[model samples]
Target: MEDPSLYFPLPTIKTLLQTFYSSFLFCFLRVFPLCLALLFETLVLVHKWSFLGHLLFVSAVVLYTTLVYHFSRPAPVYLVDFACYKPPSHLQVPLHSFMEHSSRFGCFEKESVEFMGRVIKLSGQGERTSLPPALHYIPPRTGHLDSVEEAHMILFSVMEDLLAKTRVNPSEIDVLVVNCSGFCPSPSLSSMVMHRFKLRDNVKTFSLGGMGCGAGVIAVDVAQTLLKLCSGAQAVVLSTEIMSTGWYSGKERKKLMLNCLFRMGGSAALLQSGPQAARVAKYQLRHMVRTHMGASDRGYFSAMREEDSEGITGVSLERDLMQVAGEILRMNIGALGSRVLPLSEKFWYSFSLFHKRFLDPKTEIYVPNFKLVIHHFCIPPSGKALLRELGKGLRLKKVDLEPALMTLHRFGNQSSSSLWYELAYMEAKGRVKRGDRVWQLGTGSGPKCNSAIWECISPVNPLAKVGSDPAGPWFDCIDEYPIAMDDF
Candidate 1:
């Protein structure tokens, strides 16, 4: 079946006419007095009658200038450059190879290994996804090396590519934000980036820790705020997860899901505020909504990393994660709906919610037609089950869910960077169009639902060859995706 987006025509003619009419009206109003003065002189005194033509020419030029000014105003936050970390080929681990290594590590019990096998098969990760170096070795050293490697290895590769691609000088970056859920070093990740780039003395740096998979969006939100506060400033947002320090060596089956789910990946993005940045920026930040349910017990423990029964450390996924996520999504969407949804859609949905709550508790509440607002959705590539649940929850079609699913299959869960890879997949497939609004929803350990909307500014050319970029995660195999996969 063809994608619904394919059948949906671009609003080129309607939007152009609307813009032109508005601009004309505004310019006419402002220049009306000048036109009248010129007319009066031409008719009454017959002197400076040449002023009429000059006035008319000036009016037309000013009108054109006004239209250009309106259209060319800088966005508060604009994406300049973004790059995702792709590990070396030797580090890519297949399912069977990973299983073999886990069995030989002699850390897991027989039952644990079997449980791990089941999770790995159902994980939706491809064979080429990578693991931490300590885990890659035959005898896994359950130590702090994973933390160091994750901090340096992932951040350096992505920042190098992003800065070089965007042609941004380190000194030009006025704001820096970095998020790493598991690893928070002494000087902080943001400080590391500043030190590595040797940024200006007064550069503002912040590191977000323990925010879970949704930390990337939080970083973006922070950048957006700072950009608005300080005009023409550039910001860099980096997100990653260190699975090496998070390795679960214990025999606890429940805590081992991270082993099967997480992979070696990271992403770096550049955002700036100014007409100069907007001229070349790919996407404009539109909206950001965050809902934190950490006060509740279930939410607090949803993805908590604590000592297991045997005093071994690991992150445990709460059994009721989906249920908690559903509640959080409901609240988050309601707040976001009022902001972005059309008035009619919001009124109807609000009526339904009122009826369901007041009239009939058991009555089925209507899900708002989010398709009317969002063109593309970049959801977290957590796992197959969560992906399917979100698709149904948001009422997204198969084509709409393709990016998330394919990202999950090819990259597994790259933690906060998962959504970036998903968005890149859509771009690589040429699905995202100019003026299209994309919604990115990332659920994190805070049991938080972080939502962000980005509007595409410039036309995306998927067929355009990437000349200088390194062999990243999506290279050589983007065309093979969108294949059929089991819903389970």
Candidate 2:
């Protein structure tokens, strides 16, 4: 009889050598353990030879490195040799029937009423037979080709507009980055851009899909990183949310909110490694704080809600999401504290530490005195309640959420492009001046909260004014100060 262990016997030297012909496998097997051992030894030596000390030391090093990296990170000041295009505002769904027609595909059953209410509210008190055409989507008759085809079409349309605006030869673009939240298929967005535009064979391209509303910022981060690697590459980034190819969780009110909120929107931004770009909304990327609280799997499951059973449909955010959102904020606060908080706050905490442990030895109190630095705020149009909750959680002032609420009311949640819209609103109002810092926060169903901070480097673009219209200049539009939910 064969020994039980023989059924899973290890390979002999010759067998191992034969199998190790796969270079990648051989390299990992041969090198990874050695590297790990050396790292472990180095870490041990750096500490007092205690496991806990090693862990603390390594964590401190990582934290310090990240802080220094951010502090020393080059602030990008580039002109947006870019143009925004809305496919004939007539494409906008009318307030009376936009949701009725779009939600018939079994996705809008629960929150259709809520969505319709927002649409009507945004249209204003006066009823007009012909409102300006909304940039809208052709509702997907089926979800299969919804995102893939639509993403391609949206990017193509935007690229043509950008190319026309910049008058730059399509071939001159050294790099391309495209991001779509719901639509990613064969020939990823980057490759498709290369093939569609016929760029040089080795043109650098990147496709970021499924990053959700925060993807616009994430794409900016990607472009920022890529720009660091190339000396003279021009990068174009496209962001959109394809509503047509969406999967909806059947009738779940929590899930249906997206159908009511998200609409057709896309923006194409061009970036170059040059200081001249400071004229446009100077792309002075400031601190980017990303925190993943995913280790709390229970917390993850709590916020998990799939628009489709197979997890391939439209994204449905859960209702109990505030709980997860709170956790995410905690993680981000810890991750970003070092970068955003002044040394005074840290010193105060340290003093409190000594006071509690050795001096008073009775209680512990650690309060971080952080001054609010958000000059402009852009948050997801999850809901009025959600916005309110965020304000309370973050201790945000009423003025902070005003722009966000106004945009949500007017645009009905333009998905990833909403922040850009808010940015436009701020510029229109002249709230964003040189050196002002703005924070954009995005929330999605992964119960994800992503934040990006941009520091102004130059004056706002007078010609390319954001959200400017006959209604009024940006400031005039905001005359009704301290916007609140009741106004909407």
Candidate 3:
């Protein structure tokens, strides 16, 4: 069978008719009022009304039009600030230490030990990447208590930093969203955050689990939706992956990839919707597009949690993961391009699609130049190979991929929070300027691809001092970045 993803979904006759009808109705409503105003003005002119009367009438019309336009539009959402957790240097596990620790565990076979070592060395992760304190112990303490401790350390630290920087009281937070792909406790992470900060009882709370690395953007999408409903509300999203309980003890190489790739980290961001917040916010949300291919068997099983022959449970990474990721990414960007791409690019892309489908089956489809609309990119820093594939597919230059590559080397794959770390790297380097548009692309299990666009509304200086804490996550090492890819 031909690939279903090869063709984009076309608008049906019903959809076209709905669009036409909406457009006609909107135009008629707008024009009818203007025609009435014109008629009233003509009557006033013919009747020789007083100048003051005419001025009052025109002012009333203008005022009414402004109010209608203002109330009709949805409130804008703003990203006030964000913070990424920087674990203590004591938690840093060098490659040799990590290998030694793994070998110390008698559960792994010799070949599995060697496989993990090779994966780590070529994984584009540096020696300074951190692991949880529990993992540092001999024989490793992988249990419920240890997982909760790790979660507390990461989630609370990032939340504290974000709250301090934004100075927004917990009582004022109208919504709280906490996402951890692998771990979900009894009370929920969102409830834990609320209790820790003593937030309002009525605060809207949501805890998302099993959504994989893309859940960060998914959580932000959820917050944005809620903010629209509650006018002038503030929301906070916390993203992280708890790996203490997620360690794979089995010999399955596919399951072991997660052990090598994921590291300890978390991020918290504050988003608010209102005119007042926009004045002080860093970025204004522009567009968000999410694509899911879970309906297909290959996509659904691409990455899944299951047991080995020994019944040792772990998340498996199928060999075809990259293929599935590429397909989902293509569909996601195609949807996003329709909304953000200029008319010229859209026209050529549509023409190429038509030609390829009808005129010449051999013709290749055109890839829209996203760089035309986006100034910076923060794609998932999952691994070097995936990053390289995405860079090539998107036609991104080395400079454009610098943030992701460097973030991977310095912090490893933080799962949902990896994209935020990449964004932080860019800010710490003083690269993000006012009016620059940033695109954050995230992909994960469920074979999902999500994209978020942010327009910098105000200047973002290098985070030299985050509320007198000395510096941001990358402040100490920002100057040393843009390292040669060959070094990894």
Give the deviation of candidate 1 from the true structure as CA RMSD: 10.3
* lDDT score for candidate 2 against the true structure: 0.60
In candidate 2, which residue pairs clash? Answer: 78-277, 79-277, 89-133, 89-134, 90-133, 92-134, 247-313, 247-314, 428-474
TM-score of 1: 0.83
lDDT of 1 at 274: 53
State the lDDT of candidate 2 residue by residue for 185-299, as single tens digits. Answer: 7778788778888876656788876667767777776787776543344678877776656535354555555555676566777776544445443646667776555566645
Across 1-488, the per-residue lDDT of candidate 1 in tens digits comes to 86543323233443454455457575675467557655654564554456666666567666766765654343478886577777778888888898788788888887888898899788677788888777777777556656776678889878887877777778777788999898887778788777788877777889998988989999999888877644467889999988778788997766898888888889988998755667888998888999999899888877788998889998888788878888998888888898999988888887888998899888777778899989999988877877788888878888888888888877789989999988888878778898999998888887898899999999986644332553345777887987788654
Arranged by TM-score with the best first, the candidates are: 3, 1, 2
Which segments of model 3 are wrong by more than 4 Å?
1-66
Candidate 1 regions with alpha-carbon error over 4 angstroms: 1-75, 463-467, 470-472
- Report the number of the highest-TM-score candidate: 3
Regions of model 2 farther than 4 Å from truth: 1-87, 98-140, 143-149, 161-168, 247-249, 274-281, 302-314, 345-373, 445-447, 465-488
Tens-place lDDT digits, model 3, residues 1-488: 95532232234343344344347686686677778878888888999988986896798689768855665556689999998999889999899998988998888988998999999888789989999999898788889999999999989889999989988878778899999999999889998888899987678899999889999999999999988654467899999999898999899999999999999999999999867778789999999999999999999999999999999989999999888998999999999999999999999999999999989999988878999999999999888887887888888988999998888889899999999999988898888999999999988889899999999999997754554455678977888888888743
Report the lDDT of model 2 for residue 77.
Answer: 33
